[model samples]
Target: MASDYWDRYFRRARRMRTSRRRFLLGSATVGIGAAGLGLVGCGDDDEEEPTATSEPGETPDPTATSEPGETPDPTATARPEETPQPTATATEAPPDTSAVPTDGSYYSQVGEPFVGITLDIHRGVSGIAGGVEGSAYSGLIRFDDIPAPTFRGDLARHLPEQPDAVTYIFDLRDDVVWHDKAPTNGRPFTMDDVRWNLDRQLTRTLADGTVADDFTLTNTVFTHIDSLDYVNDETISFTLKQPRGTWLESLAFAGFMDQGVAEQIESDPDVISADRIVGTGGYMFTEFVPDGRRIAERHPNWHLRQAGEEVQYFDALALLDVGADVNAVRIALEQKQVDWIGGRFQRQAYAPEFMQAIQDANSDIERLDVPALNANRALIYSWEIGPFSNPMIRQAFYLALDRQLVLQQDFAGEGRITGPLPWAFTDWALSEEEILQQPGYALNKDDDLQEARQLWEAGGGEDLEDNIELVANEPDAVRLSEWFTAMMNGNLGTDKIEVKGIPGGSILPYLTGEDPIAFLTPVSAWTSPDPRQRLARSYTTAGSINFGKYSNPGMDDLFDQAAATLDRDEAISAMKDIQRLAMTESGAGTILMAAATGRFLKWPYLKMEFNPWRLPVDERSWIDQSDPTFSGRPSL
Candidate 1:
């Protein structure tokens, strides 16, 4: 087991080294431009340069897969009623690989007679990477350009039609087609594909009517669904076990897994490659190199464009990871290798001078803070063991944390006071103005400290006589955790919370083990901006991701009341009550701290659609290399 871990570690170290070397060498050669990388077919819509050519590289040593250990559902819901003729033609012409640009990923004509621009942004992610998936894939329902509570159907003509609270139906778009490749050569996408995607997350049973032993439950949001039945070739229906208002919103969370290669790649890691991923989206999957880059080139016959929609300006979309270490991300931004940078989770460390220099050089660049309300900071206690078992101690622990210090240390002082939810979902969340008045989030902390100490003493915290291990998950949380250990001790006038920093992945096993520790981690508290969304994922008794194991009968009742209601106001009332119960009215066991707002230094030339959902790089995000900012990019 340790050997497998080290095997991954050394392989990654090697990649990081190679990435740094390439970036540094590229940085030194500023004038190389797209020309140096052998870019071909940049575009002629605005009459630009050209694109490039490369073999599709599939990484066999995959550390992350679609859903680790997941297999296609063998339940066989229904056979395809009919097979429609495939549409959406791919570019018959071979790729034009004339010149090597300084950034080869910048220009790609893998499957394109497309817009000439190529995008390169900083991204550090596992699996196929979000940009590759989001760009190539089409979901039943999708978030619009904005990240708020706005969404529209992509494959479906509109949001599913709900005939009853427990029943929903989707109207598929006839023109949508699978990407032109292998088993499914640009065939019209249909209802069957939707069902396959749905079943990927649904619980599956063997022919013996027993739940499969190793079936991967990729997502639990679909658990409410009782059954999925085919209505017709273009129509599908879903039956729910019970009525849920947020069910439609949850469908927005569903992404279509291409049926084209279901048998070949669904459960096979050996063949799973980001470049080989096929979907009906703005961009075609091109390539993905771990810790180096991810690329998706323009799809000439993308359904939207086939419908004569004016979208997807960039000839190709690229995410250059370099190495996720803070320096690599910062250097990419500093050198203009990326058009924009910053997010709630990303640990961005940049000097003011570096930012000022960009403004000095590029008058078109803009820096703005985007609220990712769901990306909230949460305090989850080990309620089953130790001091955290006591509610008073739990509350005391939460009350003593200096949120501002976490903001200052981990986020470079660019964040908000998150009590339970981030402020982005203004409709369903407590505003920063209101949250500031909460006990721990208040501008002044004198009363909060006094109460925390009193509670600590009253709860027999001194009896433990040991430093309470507090887990801080993720890199940013780790930085703030080290500082909070000292701050918390000083606040209580006694040594108390000790920082136990761990990677995000390790938090699950540590928390779910024989003796779990209290943890602080980032939660997508605003998954749907539906209050029940968070409750279902993390708060309720049956919650799939409720790592803390925090539960209350009253809280579950509130969720039921909200889900049963069709009245928006009534559901919200119940939702707010649940939020109140999380920390305001009750336990120290679980504290929701709304922390961090994302700030991005965006170049004017980047007309990319950046939303908080999935990865920030939207396929349709406009990229105009002809802009003055493009000419201003670092050249060798």
Candidate 2:
């Protein structure tokens, strides 16, 4: 079946070559679309890294009128039972909306109230849109209609290309509907939403795992010192204290929720359930049956727009998560049991066969291969060990391994092995010389053997045979580890090395100082563009995700500096310095670079954009799947 898909993909590709102009670039910027939707930020804490959002402001509105599913009377007055007692009439303060359009028709002309989509989420949401529960609500006020991180320095209207500074202000939309139709429920999501969500993350503790990064809240440099105040009945003001270059990006974060919406969910969880979910997105939850199937339909009152003309493309979306396995996905696609493949199924495991089968079966069916922004497979060493604790021994190990042989034999030559940074991220990548300068980056086999022999002799004697353990998670890592052990044993003698390959998840317990040593450990990323995440997590004792518990103050300070400064160049420099320190000094762990191996069946209509460093949620870069014209069909 997989072979069939690949055959179809090649045929489609050959056909497309005759006329199609748009080539799959393999990489694109997601900051724009993500920022425009105001959908930035880590969706959950336990699962991802801390990235920026447009603004650390407001929860999504939960009021039936403000949300997509329901509409409400803008003029309707709420009874006391409907909303919590007003602390004060914020509307009395009076906000300025002179710059905003007064005409109600402008809002209506925006077209269809909603479009629905079904996404096969690999994991479950933490129940918080941003920080508050599913119930917080508000209407689209004056929204920053641009993508993330683009409006950096201008103070202009609409979406500034670049702002003179990082400050952006928005006015709340009027007549917006929420999921629940209640007006008095916390004043229809005002400036209070912005302030409340940030405060909740900083102060509250819920069973949900979606907590804000400790640094974003406590670190003075990364903090948002913005002021929020209601301007009028249908308006509010947001002013940032400092130049937050990624203000729009920050706004899209998972942590920012509206105050009013959160209060509703906190008050009544019954208002929302597993199947009856709510959000301001184009889709509304119709039903979810755990491992069975989940469905969502277009909301009648959602605010949406078409790309060319002003109309919604999708009438509704049906997301089905049959299973995580690629074989299962192939079966479903064959049976036409699903509309399209969900994100979870988009992995290297699909192999050439799986994609080929799909292509061969249907001409209308195309693949959406979006190379994710992340270093998929990394070779991480444990620095707090017997042999690896020494920089010389670590370097010797790095130098001795044959990457070319390993890539061909173990990974079937499909994998790419380079330095610490993945190959796709060439911009911030360090050169071979720079990599070699790092403590253990050198892989000079002959020289390294001589050095290892010298070190063993210097430490004690040539008769030494210390049984050492080599550990990794995947079959490839196991194969590579075995080959490496053989090389070490053959070169340095049998008494020196013993190799063991454990499954990825099982390696955790031993990594936490249980075993005296390990190598090529796997750790998931929280977010990208934050250098401190990789640095501190792997090198510092305080790192929550640090599996090796490798500690070095020199590397720690570099991580701090990179994290402290907002300057991109300065951060880049700091990261390079840390990379050097880790590789050379064995500060945290020496990386023999990272490798990612995968095969995707290419189709004419199917486009691939890889972001090897981005969060998993952003993999939407595949096949412009969102385009209505796509239909898994190639353009003439």
Candidate 3:
């Protein structure tokens, strides 16, 4: 999601939480005190596994007004009993291996896979709409799959390259076409659409010469575009202001829209509604009910499918909005009302307890642990705010918090405490030896706390216990925040420490809004292999996603140096320099954990590959026909 929309959604969530009186519970139903809610058992293995061929049932109504099918009320409690479940019985059946296809194609027994997701969806924007759009929309180039960081052509015939390292040439696949729907009318996707999208991103201008202010969220990624020239209907070239090592990765954002649709949306802003948000993707927009559900039917003429073959493995894709109520999502999954939960950038949605509950309830539901490259879980400090404004206080705050203990207690030792860059970037990220040299990253918590107390005293030691507040939104985040509060009060001999927990959607604004002291939240880098985009988004002076308002000339200079060079070694060195400056000197923020495992739950009947870089639940997902309970199979 784009940073601005994330802030906007959090603001909305905060309003909803306050208006509905949805405060964090205190030792009520979950059977644990606020501070005692640490990570417990790893998982349960005794539960019965679900059958792959269970009789297929009717999909839950998207427009239903009641519990089993309706959109979850934001004010609903986290108790599982409060949510309704579908009554689908799973009967044991032998697997039908004979029906399995060997050529990478699988038949779907379920007409359309129902996907349960939690995110803020914006119709007009691409990345801003959250995971649903990420799966439904195709990028020019995309990561192959999880664990593999390599990029592959999705819309383009081949990967685009810059011959001169400053001029990029993209070759379009002629077979690609817009969905056979209105506005685009199944028009052949050409270089014109590509160029138009790129130009709009760069200059925010439509083909008819209208300025589109709303479409400028991605301007920073394509700001280097000096000019775009159409070589032919199938080819376009871009001249950049300078060589960018991550330019190809940036082009993925440009592939989200078709030119015809872009022109219509720009002309009549209201036409950008969900149903009219057309794209040359595998699915076409069908119906979207705000805060309810988004429905997309398979585009019959998608280019990826072979001639005379079925276009989509599933007939349609449904994205349910359970808001930030993770319990509601879990209930829907357990009942088989939704096939899978968690999508693009949704790693934090699964708390440790929730994962354990899913394991205990269903054996057929498998949790895939995917590597979170360039994803960091950290407590961000607002340098522009009160006590955090003082560098000494910022450093002291980092030292006071026991990241290792938090990781063990909150994540069950499934994660490693890290520095500025996540550990997944082994090449560019600091090593254990190097990270130990930095303050607040060392293993000895007692020694760090002593130093933190001394520093706190030196920096005009007022009782910060009562003055400062730590905020977090998700269940795990809330636990971490409360843990930090307890550590400060107990270790530092201070009595006043406050911790507030809200919904995940409310976290962004609390951290980014007016004078935020500190917030516990996770930060994810762009899916690009290069670390330049990540650095630019996090530490740069004009960074759109810099929620903490952390700005340092030294850090900005290092980022600029990294982006200005195409030399791989030089860029990596510059990025490392920026990381060191942000973590150590500038005290931009503290990185509590890095590359923590993310769990994805998929039903036994669903067959799909988990793509960490894209949505975990993809639109191209198919059903395993080898399961004897295949519902759509012709009766023999």
In the order shown, what is each candidate's alpha-carbon RMSD?
A: 18.2, 17.0, 16.1
**In terms of TM-score, which candidate is strongest?**
1
Local accuracy of candidate 2 as per-residue lDDT tens digits, 408-512? 443344434455543323334466456554433445556656665665555443443565666654553555555666766666544566667665455545556
- Per-residue lDDT over 392-479 for candidate 1, one digit per residue giving the tens place of the 0 to 100 score: 8777776787777655654455445665545544445565676777777777888888999998899988777777877764444455
User: Local error of candidate 1 at 262, Å?
Assistant: 2.4
| Deviation from native of the Cα of residue 566 in model 2, angstroms | 3.3
TM-score per candidate, chains pooled: 0.70, 0.61, 0.68
The best-first sequence of candidates by TM-score reads 1, 3, 2
- Compute the lDDT of residue 275 as modeled in candidate 2: 32
- At residue 473, give the lDDT of candidate 3: 54
- Output candidate 2 Cα RMSD: 17.0
lDDT of 3 by residue, 153-172 (tens): 66766666657868867777
